[model samples]
Target: MWSRALRSNLKLSKSEACIFFKNKIRGASTCVEGEPEGPVVKTDIPGPKSKQLLQELGSLQQVGTIQLFANYDKSIGNYLVDADDNILLDTYTQISSLPLGYNHPELLKVFNDQHNMKCLINRPALGVFPGEDWPKRLNGILSEISPKLPNITTMMCGSCSNENAFKNIFIAYQRKKRGDVDFSEEEKSSCVLNQPPGAPKLSIMSFKNAFHGRTLGSLSTTHSKYIHKIDIPSFDWPIATFPQYKYPLEDNQRENEEQDKKCLSEVEELFEKYEKKGIPVAGIIVEPIQSEGGDNEASPQFFQQLQKIAKKNNAYLLIDEVQTGGGCTGKFWCHEHFNLETPPDIVTFSKKMQLGGYFHTAEMTPRQPARVFNTWMGDPGKLIILQTVLRVIKEQKLLDNVLHTGTLLKIGLLELEKEFCYLLNSTRGRGTFLAVNATDSKLRDEILTKLKAKGIQSGGCGSNSVRLRPALIFQEHHANIFLDKFRQVLKEIN
Candidate 1:
């Protein structure tokens, strides 16, 4: 019945419906017209061509992270084509960066406009000199996707966005303390020398398993992995514990509530501890769902209480939505699901948004010019692409599609968890940004390898969780493909 409904909604014929269900549908769907019927594996993932290219590129640079060389030109929606002509269903979607997927027709045609072409060719130092249309473009974007924050400061990428957002928060924190007073001479001179009163020992509190960024300041707050911080001189900042809830949350409500209380208590203690140490926390940065650290999630009640705590301490809350934004979570932002009493002080974004930046409250906007300035603050070309992406998202009601497909996917995963009992568990997440855990990291890696061999390109996070970061256009059929492939992988492992 559901399959029939899907066919009716998508307007697929009998043969087309069969292919869609069987995970083989050649260019027949309207949503992603040129997308392949399903993944086609012609060779081993790092096939002959990719291996040779990796060897060639390895000579000039460290290529440890290069998994496989891709042929973007041949790639289509929900599918990535490798240099060896193997087509794989790309659930990770370039680490959750691709919004509409590879070679999206609308995105490809965006540069066809002479104005957009000029925006790409004549990139300006946006801080110093912006085109006349820059303000108009920004206004359109703000109107369409501002998260209710009035001000936005665009930047280069996720790292810099978080880095600069920390600065903004610190500036606001100090400005509130200064109370319209001009900077004193000592503050100016001391800051020049990186001393007290100028470069005050302010800090941004982050969670234990958080992955904000790798810039000098943001790196100090990042605690996900040792390699990201090894040998780097980091500030002495307070690290709070993020809530670690047990799986099947409904069945573990009391335990999860206690976990939230425990984590929140840690946060309050750290606030006081930092205050007493003379290095007050200016802000708290967190991911709605800790993407890189793990697909760890906290309850909406936890976020509401955390926001209240931030208000009580006068420290701003900065939600890092770099990976969880852009309608993947069945909403424009994952934090929206939390329904906080008030909006976060700053909401940093990038990933699917094309350009990186933060939506900040009026107070968070620095009073002094150039306080958070940078050359080429953001690219107009990227904004042009983003505008099209947003349009497509709304026109197709992709958010609704995400919710529907996510329900089916999650249900399928839960069933698999029951069937594969020992091998899989802890299925969690919203929309298509879902994840399931294996027994251990080794088994997780093995599962991912087997899935990829079956032409499903997925990713792992934290230690043993397989995360799904499919494009927003991912539909019911796509979810079926992944579930089918995943079930096969589990069977093999068993």
Candidate 2:
């Protein structure tokens, strides 16, 4: 049925056809041919080889976060091959960046095309000397994947995208105030000196526990972990509480609704407080779902109201979809689920999108060039890869795949939460971007360690949540493997 549907809806290339037919069996053990049938833990996770590699790498720089050294050549599909030859089913998906898993055939063939190889090798300072096809390329790709916003500014990564986006927000804000006028001499000179009227005392309000990025500007807004911010000077911008709801949402509707109200009320208060402090908020930035902060989710109504608050305060709403975009939440962008009255003023994305950038309204476009730019505003090479990723996603109906696989994964998690009530709870999130809370941070770490030992490489978030960030290609069979392993771990703990 899947193969017939693919054939009828679109013409598959010889390679694509092979991929589909190879995995067409009703209960196939693996999706990618030559991929492992199941994980093989030849040794402990960071077994001898990985430890030796880590020791060697530690000499160059800080390796505190090094887990295991991967042998990319051996990895395929959802399995990660470590230096020790241990094959682990990877649910974290390279911190949720690998859209198609390791070395997908289509992606590998991308550079085989001479034009693409040229794009990759002959890197240009895109800001000044872009290829003639750059505009056409952007239009073609953005036409397929962009949010409702009409303008876009390509960037390098999540942090750089968010950092540059702050410039756009501030520029637009001041432009509105100084409508149709050229900058005065004082404004120009003051800006160079980092003073008022030019580099204004405007602010971008962010939510507590939000992770925008780690760059200086974006870092000020990031509050996920203190280690990422300790001793670093930050702006005193307003910080509002994000909605925290009790789980099994149907059971605690009233309390959750009240929680939404409390958060929204706090947002309003902060806007007023910041205005009184003379650093009026120029914009409000938030994550659709706080991925790094325990996969925290907010109600659709909460977001709808939040958007209204931003508009009322004459501030732009920037939905930082760095972790929630690119179909992870069953929709291409997670905010699509909110049903807002209007599109957000800015929607920043990275990770699965292949490159960093923001979709924004025309109002956010700077009056002058170089106002929001860098040497390589963005890599044409990444766009080439993204072109293929988007094509595969559409041609393969991967968004629908995400919806189906996510249902299986979330249902299994909910069931586990019930069975291991003392050890687990709060199974939450949309699509494959789900998470579940353990008894505490300590137990959460233990659960992750045990799962890793059992050949399931998952990840944790916030204080105690296990986050699932599987690739879009992840299917029901993969979900079953994870659930079976997770159940085993929970049973052993119980």
Each candidate: RMSD: 5.0, 5.6
Per-residue lDDT tens digits for candidate 1, residues 1-494, read 98887666433457545644543323314478878889999999899999999999999999999999999999998999999999999999999999998898888899889989998999999988999999999988888898899999999899999999999998999989989889999999999999989889998899998998899988988888899999999999999999987988767889999999999999999999999999999889999999888899998999999999999999999999999999998789999989898889999999899999999999988777899998899899999999999999998777767766776788799899999989988999987889999999999999999999999999999999999999988988888899999999899889
lDDT of 2 by residue, 279-353 (tens): 999999999999898899998899999999999999999999999999988889999988999999999998998
RMSD of 2: 5.6
Evaluated at residue 389, the lDDT of candidate 1 is 98
* lDDT: worst 10-residue window of model 1: 19-28
lDDT of each: 0.90, 0.89
TM-score of each model, in listed order: 0.94, 0.94
| Cand. 2 Cα-lDDT | 0.89
